[model samples]
Target chain A: MPTAIEQELRPVAPSKLSLRHVSKIFRGQSGETLAIDDISLDVSEGEFVCLAGPSGCGKSTILNLIAGLEELTSGEALLDGAPITGPGRDRMVMFQEAALFPWLDALGNVLFGLKLKPNLNNAERREVARFYLRLVGLEKQENANIHELSGGMRQRVALARSLAPNPRILLMDEPFSALDTLTRETLYRDLQSIFSKRRKTIVFVTHNIREAVCLGDRIVLLSSHPGRVREIFTVNLPRPRDINDAAVATFAHQITETLTQYLETPATKEAVL
Target chain B: MKRNLLTLLTFAAVLAALEVAGRNGAWDTRVLPLPSEVAAYIADAFTDGARRDQLPAAVTANATAATLGTATSTTAASLWTAFAGSTLTEALLVTLKRLVSGYLIGFLAGIPLGLLTARFNFFRETFGLVALGMQGLPSVCWVPLALIWFRPTENAILFVVVMGTVWSLMLATEHGVRTVPPLYVRAARTMGSRGLHLWWRVLLPAALPAVIGGMKQSWAFAWRSLMAAEIYVTILTGCGLGWLLHNGREVLRMDQVMGVMLIIVIVGLTADRILFAPAENRIRARWGLDKN
Candidate 1:
């Protein structure tokens, strides 16, 4: 841990968000089930960090906790040393479902996000919305209804909506997992470029190993059965890294080996004891 | 277009069959008049000199006698002139006024209550369930209560109309608000929309299709209730189409009775086509719920 003064003086800080000993337990009629057990991680500013794990790993739960969409059972999630209270304009989320309001057109949906900015007048808000629509390659489909757009286009509109607010942190939970392989590949390309240009502090959650390796600066691997941080791998690969690249494959292979080790070893069965 | 043509063709065929039946006395002419004669009667009812010639003095005497002192004691010619001329139009206008006012009052009260009931558990368990129960009760069942409360006045008719409609509107609104996807609400909240703003932007738009559907149903209920109140209650208000339909039957003028029935059917169809259908189609189209 660095002192407050030291943290301020540092040219490039290590963390934009810090989670300390966070745990989540869900209570049901059957009894209590520990979803996450004392997980801690730091995500730096302008860094794309992926919380990658198998199903039931509480990866999505962690994203929700950081989003302030859910209350933590214990511990804290801090944004710039301040505890996240609730959903705010400072942190925008793109859900797995595009979740665009069907009643609004693409431009209207993006403009809705711009409503968070009190400074912009109607005209200025519209201009900002149009700019984001263009950025997401949806300039032509601004007036199109959600059902009229392709699944990929709907996600693009959702991306534009999330970006229009210019939130400091973007939380995405398996946003592209529903799209086809080709559509997901195209999105990966666009997302990388967008990340480069916008430099937003993004926390992406995914179960795909290659997706995590392709987009994240640092990947935090979580193991299931009371999800705990199994490992953290920093990808030293350059920007615009392809999912099919050999370097990504090497890193993915290494992460998979560790994950396999955890699955095979009975020593880690200390989980109950 | 082809479907509409088919509908028109079927209607024309029915009218032709009715004309044949009426000419050959297949059934008593008094039982169901010739469709052509009913159409002609309706047309003549609107024309001044033509209606005066067509309305017989014997029919007028019979109308006044059947209801006794309840029918105003004007001379046959004067009564026919008044009934066919200004009275018919005046009746339509008065009925329209009552329907619109009652429907509007129900709409104004029901929508907010529904939204509130859907959002709050207390409201849902109380007013929401009560409203659903009220909808199951027949619209005419409120007529007796309305008559006792307001007596023989315009307010009585208005009260019945409101009672007939408000519960359905409330239930529709509650259902609409309740069924709005949680995804949209969550998404809106994350975008910094809270409280009333959240309801206005996300919840209202998401619930609009169902709300409009409810409004259409309320209008139908209000219209039906207005007709029933006008016919049953001896109110000291202006006569409406229902009064005319009652009078037409009393005089044993089957053609006149059928003409009024045609008008009622036409008015209802016109309102549905002009007001509700286009609005529903527009909502469906904009929301991408329109498959076509």
Candidate 2:
């Protein structure tokens, strides 16, 4: 095993996102509701971490907090030792809905991400956009308008757009959940390949256990009703894991069993009640 | 293609029925002239000799006398200019110019005001009620105040037109900006867009469909207001399409009146069909906003 001093002397990975005892409380007419309980998570550089749980678990809330879309009610979310105050291009988010600008075609949508990189001229930007479009296997549909693309194609365009910025951290909020099972499986493979090649710190939020088991290096199970981390499982499965593979299903089943046990626990039971 | 042909046929049928009605004396000639007679009268107004002959005797005398005060007399040498200026086409050009200018001014002012109102709660609370109130108040209602303030000039007409369309434009802009899906804004923000850049890239484009819809409505209001302004303010000058209608009615030239009315209808339809509709369709097609 590599010694701690050897690791310290080694070239550090670029992105290491840390959420230190983060909590979120939303106050409305119904009164104060704890959306996220105190939860701490550390995602090392180039690691694929998935927040997996059922709905109302604040999995998306945590993702949003990490993305700097919403401020933490307590504690801090840090990127490379600095607390995240607001949204930045360094942390690009891919939403479940594909949230693409309808007015922009596929190439245009991808180019939109390059807008932040002011150093690139128009030609350079176009080249970069084309590169990402091809990476997402959407080179042919570059000129196709948002409405012209199917749901899977739209998501691919969105993925291209998010990746075009070449952010240090990619925060995905159930990106493949909206697609059909077949498309989702294909995207799972593509996403795994992209992850291996790109080597970026990614925080993916998904309720699907199989998805989390297949894609994530580590799965962070969040319990519902004032979401808190229930269990953390390190998937020892090999790279480019198939969602339908027995190993993936076994890990998924194990995570699900742990999640159900956590749900049956007194604290979560009372919260649900 | 079939729809357009059907529309043309229906229009021709209406014109034929009207011509037959007039020829059969279903109504007195004084009440309504034959469509062909109106068409001929409009054509004659454009023709050189017939236009020269149509000038009043006193105006003709003034042109020959070359009085110092007769600065704008219809002299024989400048006969076409005078005739053209008074004809439906010339009136149309003047009216369209005013309508476009006034509508543009309102549109420019309205978009910023709408953006401000939509973005800020304070502006929305204060100006929102005023915009709603202005929408209820007709453009014609502003004419009286405009006349007193601008003294029956082009300014007065412009004032009325602006008042007519500005509120609608502002309201449309406000609604458009406000209704931009939170998702798009949030998405833009995550992409490191902020301030004016965000507004230009995300907010403005997001609100375009609504803004265009507003502009179409604004054009209609501005066009109507211009007609009202010309008829009322240019009682003495008789400068535009509205003035032509007023002059025809005053002189009991029923053919000229009918001809001007037809021009007005044509202008209105052309603005909607030829200009606004195509623009709207293009945007809808690009954005996939419209259903097949």
Candidate 3:
């Protein structure tokens, strides 16, 4: 109700981010392949949107486009009403692979993200990097080598790195898919806590339906093979929704049923979880 | 601990068998000298006043003085007598200085060239083709050109050493940059890394493993080329291990030849273990590129 009141008050506010009729075609030796087609989306400031679908749904491709890693074949990607021509620290990306530089320790890896920040001296940068590491519950492990950290810990370090730049938007591409179930659940709770504290607009890509239900303010369901917007589901469930909560399951079931109407693939069957 | 013991035991067994063969006359001592005799020759290097002396090579009037105007036989004579009175250790120092200097130059020059070769088509078509083509030529083949251009001075030796190693360094660096994981690059790019920052922070580190591999091979080539240069173009008053080996051969002293060969093998292994192994291990461990 407060969010509704806030939205009503800011009725004329421009969208924080928008993808206007975006399309992408990849040309390989096999010839032209349409990656995604005519996908339009608008994400308000501080909103958590999840793009969910099966493999080859171009969920990652869309994230890549938003991150300015890939060029769109057609249409516009705008941020705060301005066209996004390239990548910047304002929209940082977290890949599935933590992608930490091996030569650096955990703190050093986070510091690397702050290399472009010209104002801060070396000491200030270390302090900032340390602060972010503390935020991710990795303060004790800052000196740990990249390979020494667990897979979950590695992602946590990556999350700290992406956050350290203080980006306006965070693009995460299945950042937790490779983690174990328990780790994913724990990260969900931690993420929700972090999301509440630092209200950055987030676009998360995932194949996990319940995960989408738990984390997203709105889930943007995508269809595969030249990905298109299938539907959008809003989760009005209360704050810090647990993945195993009965309400979360009901919402997940509801979304799966909607997906079943269009997709009979094995991916829809996977949507139940 | 156990593996090291096994290696030592195996080596001793080989040495023992060779010693027995020499006593039984399995092969002529002239062609294949006795292991014991070779050991004696090495010991002789320690005790012989002339062998142990680090004095400057005797520049007698009769000794062949090599200038560019002379023939190959005269050059061979100059090389043979270059370290006749000086200690083998002095020759060793000369070889090592050339090897270190050449490898260092190649490293400094090759990194940027390799990066350029990988990134730009301009370099790939021009320098890249040259590097690849040069790989086919043996390091010794460059000696003739090096001698003509630099006239058998220290510069000529250094030139041969650089030419021998630079091509491998170039190819390795290019290959290293080209094969860096796309994900790492993409990840860096998304973090607002571009241009020189990206190259220095991401691309260079990612390419390190491959570059290090190239370094190992180039080091071996450096030693090979230094020897070739020392043996062929020895107009310099100072000598290297190659010149020492040539000296032994010219005298037809098989024991001295075998003794110097033993020193070469020991030096080669030491370089690999002492200079390169720890670096390779550290990179592999830190980068998670190890087989574990």
TM-score of every prediction relative to native: 0.89, 0.90, 0.88
TM-score of chain A of each: 0.90, 0.92, 0.91
Model 2 chain B: weakest 10-residue lDDT segment is B60-69
lDDT of 3 by residue, A1-273 (tens): 454223222223223999999999999999999999999999999899999987777899999998998899999999998888888888989999898888889999898878788767777778878878998899999988899999999999999998887788989999999999999899999899987787789999998899999999999999888899999998999988999999999999898887777777665555332
Give lDDT for model 1: 0.83
Cα lDDT tens digits, model 3, B54-170, are: 343442111221221222234544434433433555667788898899888877887788999999999999999999998778888988888788887888888888888899998
Off by over 4 Å in 3: A1-15, A265-273, B20-27, B46-86
**C-alpha-based local distance difference test score of model 3:** 0.83
- lDDT per residue (tens digit) for residues A145-262 in model 2: 8999989999999998888877888999999888999999899999999888877799999888899999999999888888999889999999889988999998888888877776
What is the CA-based DockQ of model 1? 0.64
Q: Candidate 1: where are CA atoms >4 Å away?
A: A1-15, A29-31, A264-273, B1-3, B48-85
Task: Name the regions of candidate 2 deviating beyond 4 angstroms.
Answer: A1-13, A265-273, B1-3, B48-86, B235-238
How does the DockQ of candidate 2 come out?
0.69
Q: What is the C-alpha lDDT of each candidate?
A: 0.83, 0.84, 0.83
**How high is each candidate's interface RMSD, in Å?**
0.9, 0.8, 1.2
Candidate 2 structure quality by residue, lDDT tens digits, B50-158: 3345676224211221122232344675655545543555567788889889998998888999999998999888987799999899888899998798887888888
TM-score of chain A of 3: 0.91
Candidate 1 C-alpha lDDT tens digits along B195-214: 99999998988999999999
Clashes of 3: 0
